[model samples]
Structure formats: structure tokens, C-alpha cells
Target: MNKGKGRELRAMLRDWRAAAGVYASLQWRCFHQDGRFDPFLDPATQYRKDGAKVRAGIIRQIVLKHELDVPVPEPVKEGEKPKKRVLPTPPGLSDCLAPMKAALGAAQVQMVQGQVIGTLKSFISNRQNDFVDIVLGSTIDDLGRRQLFTINRATAWFDLGRSVKVETVEIPLSARLLARKIMSHILARHKKPSMKRIGMVVDKRVAELEESRSATSHDLWLKVTVKSGDHRSRRIAIPMRSNDYFSSRQGERKKTFQIIEDRETGRITVGVVTDVGSSFEERRMAYASRAQGPKALDFGLVTMFASDDGDLMGREFLRKLKSIDTTISGIARHVQRSGGKPRDSKRYVAHVTRLRGFITTELRRILNRFVAVRKPTTIFLERLNFQSPELSRRMNRILQNCGRGVLRAKLQALNEEFGVESHEVVSAYTSQTCSCCGYVDRRNRKAQAVFACRWCGRSLHADVNAARNIGSERFRSIGSARRVVRSNVLDMLVTQHVQRNTGERGAPADPRMSNPHFAAWADKARLSTKAA
Candidate 1:
């Protein structure tokens, strides 16, 4: 392409991105607002009621009234100067504002609105657990050869092409003045609209796009539009790694996909859903054929994971994590002393990101190794609550917030990959209770690393002993015990120990119960039983 065409293409891409931003902002407003229909109901039924169109119209009215009320430049006539054009005011309306200059097409706008509604439905249906940020990308349909976006294989590279039409429409103002006033009043009562970028959620046809690529290469050339006419397109070759590892594992490509973009980095990512059940099942069976009995995992800050088999993974994980946390804490303290927000400091933000990245990488590596080496049919884990005295309170909070979620997700991925079953055991007194003799006493844990049983003189690493108890049948049996109080659990453990040692169903007087702690727990248990 010539320099002029190259510049023009760059300009068009900017316009496309700007248009997407506008749509995203509109969707954000619609999602936060109370719509006419319930978000919990069927999204299809809501769409049929023109819910998206109505919400879009409302947001457009507000934007035009407040943000884009300026006169737009009209097309220049031959031998004449370009004129400033203003939209004609509709009957019974006071304002004569035009739509946004970088506005998307009606279909695209409706698609954005539908996406907002669908997000709301999902959030509500999922009991509002996970809240995701709105992403920016135009939703494109796959129409085979005529699709807006297509993936074509070339001699040395793959061509990622998009044919886009940039068209603006003069939306008719049909609502009565009184109705307009009511909408303005309602909008004014809500929070001010914030800008967001367009996000894409594609459904069906992505599988066809994936299948179209018969071969894989490490090169990609993107074809985007340079002009605003009907289906104008231009190709730009850019080199990127093929991400072959992920591509190779994609068993059967699915229909749904996502086109995500990072505004800060200007990076575009395309994610395709794939079904790997059959391959995963085959691997699972192979692992199961050679897998040993169940293993319990005790997670810790010093050691990443300590299994019942005395295997301690990522022993230096805490040292590395604490080093990063110390730096972060120092930065935070410095920022606090300067009366500035830690988030506002570039160094602070970088360190925080680094800490998160380290946690993610370490967790992934450690978990993968554990699953591969142990090859346990089932793994038991305590409900994660990571705390450490070696780090600052702030850093500990960060670890819990960031590390816990990542750990859970990694475990889930392991389950999906290897068909390893994972169960959460009650962590209460796992460290204090002796794995060998089932003795429940706080003093049994002599130190952070030592587990010296007071009853049976059993000694081992504290975390390993806890892991063994977590995997024990006795632990599994009392897993359903209600933890209304600390003493209740202690009494149950004492009763189980007595029954096991004496080979009797009733909790008989045992020599171990001569200890003050056990005697007190037994008395409490008797009182609770009498009250019941």
C-alpha cells in the first residue's frame, strides 16, 4: 500500500476503535440502569420485547443531549466550503441534537445492548458471585465466504481478515416532549454514565473458522478496513507467535469464542472454546490405571503444598513470595508517608503486578508437578485460608485475596485434565490433632514445622501430619460434623479416639482422657447431650 493509503487505513482503524468505545459506554449505562424487564428472566424473551432498542435509544438521547450536542461537519460540495450541519428538532421535542459522530450501525448498537442484558442475566443467575469488566470489540458474524471476519491460510502466514462497513444513520426522534422529559428526569436520578470500550462475545460459527485452518504457523497478518464505504477492507501483515501449545491441545473447536482487547497495551486476543473431553478421559484412565490411593494436600505459606506422602512442593515459595511482599510493603509505606495512593505510584503498581504474576506462575507449576508425580486417584484439600506472620498484615491480605482464587482455579483445571477428584476437608484442628493416635490437643504442634503427639509419642512435620489426618477415613467421617463451637469438634475427636483404642461403640473412660483438656471436653459433651 502507498503512504496515503496506509495513513488512511490507520485513521479508519482509529475511527472503528472510537465507535466501539462509544457502543461500550452505551452498554455500560444500560446494564447499570433499571430496565423495563427483569434481568433474571429469559434473555431471548427480553430481546423480543425491544428491550435492547429502548435502552439504546435512552442512552443515545442522554449522550447526544449532554456530550455530543456540537454541530457536525457536513460533506463539502463541488467548489464550495463544507457547512456545519445540525439535526432538525422533531415535533414536540425541545433539543435538535444529532447522534454520535463515531456511532456504530443500528445492528451493532442492538448487539451491544443485547450483550449488556445477557451479562445482567448471567450475573443475576449466578447469584452475583463473579463480576466481570466490560471488554471492547465489535461482534462479528461468520457468513462462510461472506463473513465479516475470516481466517485464511497462506504460504507462510495465516491471514486474520475483517470486512467492516462504517455507516451512520439519522435516528428518528419520535417520543413526545413529556416522555422525553420523564426519561431525562429518570436518568438524572441515577449515577452519571461512565465510558467503556466495546467487547465481543461470539456465538456459533467460530468452529468453522478454526476448522478452516488446516495447518498452523507462527505468523499472522491482520486485514482491517481503511475506508468507510460498503465492506471496505485492507490487509496488514504482522508477525506473532502461534501459541502452538494451546493450539495443539484444542481437541474439538466449539462454536463460541471471544475477541478481547486490552486498551492499555493495545493487544488483541482471540479465544476459541474447544471440547477436550474424549482426550482428557483417555489420559484420565491412563493415570487412574497406575494411580495410587488418595492423597491429602495441606497448603501453606512457607511450603506451597505438603502432601500426606511427605512430599513438600515449592519449599522456597514463601521465601520468594515474602521477598516480593517486603518490597511491596516498603513501597506502600513510602507512598503512605508521602500521602499518596500506592496505586498512583508506578513502582508500587509494577511490584503488585509482579507479585500477582509470581503467585500465578508458582501455583501453576507446583500443582502441575504434584498431579504428575503423585498420580493420586483423589486429592483432599482444606478450604484455603493462607496466613503468615512472616509478612505484613497488608501483604497477607493480598496473598489471601489473590492466592486463594488462583489455587482453586488451578486445582479445578487439574481435575478437568487428569480426572482427579478433589474434596475439601474441615481444616479445624487438623494441625493440632495427631494423625497417628487421633489425639486432639493444641500442644501437639510444638512448633510451626513440628508435630509431636502428646498421647502416642508420634512425631513428624506438622503440615505432613495434618495432610495425613485430612486424608484419613476418621477425618472424612467427621467431615460433616457441625462446627458450632470449638469444643464440639474437640469432643468428637476425643470420642473417636476412645472408640478406636478401646474397640467399643460407647465413649468409655480411657487413660488418655485423664488429661485435663480431654476431661473438660468430655464434660462439655455430656452437658450438651443432656441439653439435647
Candidate 2:
């Protein structure tokens, strides 16, 4: 009876504390914005400010709220112009209170001041004598409302030496059957927008072009006009960069393309950069299997998905997202200059969304091809839980739009259909540890793309090295009570990796080696250890 009274008191205190916090926050905003010291104002303003400050201090004691660290932009160069400042406006009281309800919902936290609420009360009413406090909980109804105190935890003290027995229940699922079920569930539950829409858009654009130009011949090039001030203009040539990686002038122009001038404005115009879908297709095809692997009972596909500096693929994707962010900046600039509509983001947003869809879809398809070639595969993935402050807003946006969870769900569905398995393991130290020598140090990975081990003095591509560690890391087994931690076995494979690139000579190994395999590296490491 006393415990019940204590809970009611605490619940009332919590509500009062929340109300005080809301008022304090509003007062703080007012004082900070408009309540600054003004000699022209009345003396009463000073007293009111002092009282609000005291109230803010008192509310801080009762409320447990932590502020999020907001990111700031980098400083501009010395000669560059500074941006204009914008005035801040405080949100309404109801807007401030809405987040409290969301916070409570997420935590499944509730407080009831008086009597038990609903069906949960009935379940506990029968056992009321045995319990000191009866907690009630319920789901949100169709009316977008949930019962008060619908979720809760309680503290109760029992007589000494009293114990309860718990039973273990087995969920009946065979390895093959489980895989099949998982794959089926994913295929049914996960959905992606059709790519046919993009094709349709492209086809419609082509049809419009044909309708406007009846004299057009069978050619890849199309003419476009540019308008400017009235002045005669001449055609100029623009150069194209070379594709050879080893060429000194790789980024320099080796060939020039003809550019035409507009008759009306005399402004020089060039062809629009489009029809690059073929390039994406080529990149997608590169990830496909060259040859089929031997049939085995188990085939594992380890996916390394992370967004640290060491992640090359992540960094590359971030670069693409950053390029798109330039468009966002341009949009913002346009809005500021013209004082345009505030909510005009549909055009740029759609572009980014479409690009993200293409990238993620291509990634899934590539991974699926690898699985298809090697059936009965178990895919290893890193358990991603936290967000890193080191990631830029652009990088975070790319990751969010890419949808890692969606990819995992799709992989799970693959398991059901193709006997593929997906498993998650702790991601820590995977990028730092050397896969060949088990030598882990911060200096091993200094650059974004390079991993040079300090202890073994072996170097490899950072992403490939991290992927190797992920593929080799120990994982949880079915029916096992605890997760397994595998022992490090760094062996002669380090020597083999060096020799493979340097041809057994003492010279340094080449940084770029085709067909890097983690299993082969493991085998070499084991052999090297035995030879020693």
C-alpha cells in the first residue's frame, strides 16, 4: 500500500517537472532574444529577467534533458565573402510539448496518478493480494491514442529464500527450412520502387526530341542552343580527359569536342552531359562473378558496411552525395536572392532520391549475383548501432537514403530462397586490425584507402583489409548460449601476399593487386606460421 502511494506521488512530480521545464524553456528563449539589457526599457524588465533566470535554474534540476550537438560549417577563406545572418524564431508551446509525447512513446514509459486503466487491470486484479503494485500496459488504439500507464516496470521485494523456475522453449526450425522461410518473408515484406519509371521518363524525353527535329539523322549527338546578350559568337573546342590510369596526362585533355554559338545571344553552348546510364551498368557488371565456385553445404558472403574515413566505398559514395549537395546550396542561394517560396525542394529532392535508388539497387543486384553463383551462402554483416559525429551531414544523408536496413532485409529474403544466411557481428577493430598478421594499431590505417600494418609491415587496401577481418571474425552459432571469439592465426600468408606482388624479391609489393581474397590470405598466414 505504501509503495502504491509512493508511485502516485512520483508520477505527479514527473508531470509537474515537465510543465515547469516547458515554461522555463520559453522564458529562456524570450530573455535571450528580446529581454537583453536596454537603458530605454523600464526597471521592471530587469527584475523580470532575473526571476526567469532563477526559474530556469530550478527547472534544470528537475528536468533530465540533454542537448544534441549541432554541427557548424567550416570557416571561409580570408578573401571570401561572409554569409548573411538570419533571425531565429522560437516555436510555439504546443510544438515544444509534442516532442515530450514522442519521447515517452519511444521509451514505452508511462505514469498513472490514480486507478488502474483497462484490460491489464483485470489480469492483475485477480492476483492483487500477491502483488504490492499492479502495472498496466496497452498498445496504441486505431484512434491514434494509447492508455495512460500503458507500459511500465515495477519494483517489488519478496520473502527471503523464495525462488521461481523458468522454462526454456525451443522454436522448431531446421537450418534449411529456416533459411527458406526467412528468404520468403523478406521477398514478401520488402519493396522497392520500379526502375521502369526512369526508363519511361527517358523514352518520353527521346520521343519529344524526335517530334521537334524531323531533319535529325542517325547519330549520338544532339544540338542545343544557348542565349546571351546580342553579339556574334564563334564555336570553340573543349577537350576530353584520357582514360589510361598510368598516363601522366590522365586528367588532361587529349581530344577536343566542337562547341557551337547561339545566333541570338552569341553565347557559346555545349552538349548536355546525359545518357551515362551505360557507365553505371558497366560498374555494376564488374562486381559479378567471373567463374562459379565449387558446390558446398555452406557459402558465406561477408558485407562490410561502415562510414568511417577508412571505408573507401563509403567515402566514394559520400563524394557523390556531396556533389548533389552543391545543387542544394544552389537552391538555397536562389531562394535567398529571389525571396522564393520556402518549401520548393521537390525537384532537387527527387533527383537525389532517384540517384540513391539506382546506387542501392545496383549494389543489391551485384551482391545477389555473387550469392546466386554460390548457393547455400551465409552472409556476414557488421552490427551497426551508433552514429558517429565525425560523419558529415552529406555522408549521413547518403547512408540514410541508401537504406542499410532495407539491404539487410533483402539479404534475409535471399537466405530463404537460395539457402543464403545473413549474420551480424561486432564491428569494432575490424578496420584497424591487419588481416594477414593479426597486428592491430592506429598507425596501420593512416589514409582513407591504405592500410599499412605497423607490426608485420604489410600493406593493403584499407577497405579490402577490413572486409577480410569481417569475413574471418567469429560469429554466434545457433542454439549457442554465448557468442564465440576466434583466436588470431597470423601466419606465412603475409609473406605470400608480399611475394605475390613483388615476385619473391625484396622490393615493396604493388599497391594494386587484382583478385584479392581473404581466404587465400588466411591460408598463407597459417602456412607462414608453420614454416617459422
Clashing pairs in 1: 135-198, 135-199, 136-198, 136-199, 137-198, 137-199
Candidate 1 structure lDDT? 0.59
Give the TM-score comparing model 1 with the true structure, all chains together. 0.60
lDDT of each: 0.59, 0.38
Candidate 1 residues 227-257, lDDT tens each? 3445444334322344777558747866554
Instruction: Put down candidate 2 lDDT per residue, 1-532, tens digits, no spaces.
Output: 1344334323423433353344334433443343211223222344455555554544443332332243222334699654333323222312444444343221111221011122223333323322211111113232211111111111111111222111332212232232233233433453422211110011111211212223333223222111112322222112222234323321222122223333223233333223334443453354333323222111111222421212322334444555656675566567667877423556545655565675577557655655555432355556543223444565455555456665766776565444455666445556667777665455678887678985467787776676566555321221111122222212233333455543322235322222133445445655775788
TM per prediction? 0.60, 0.33
Error of 2 at 432 (Å): 1.1
Model 1 alpha-carbon miss at residue 125, Å: 6.5
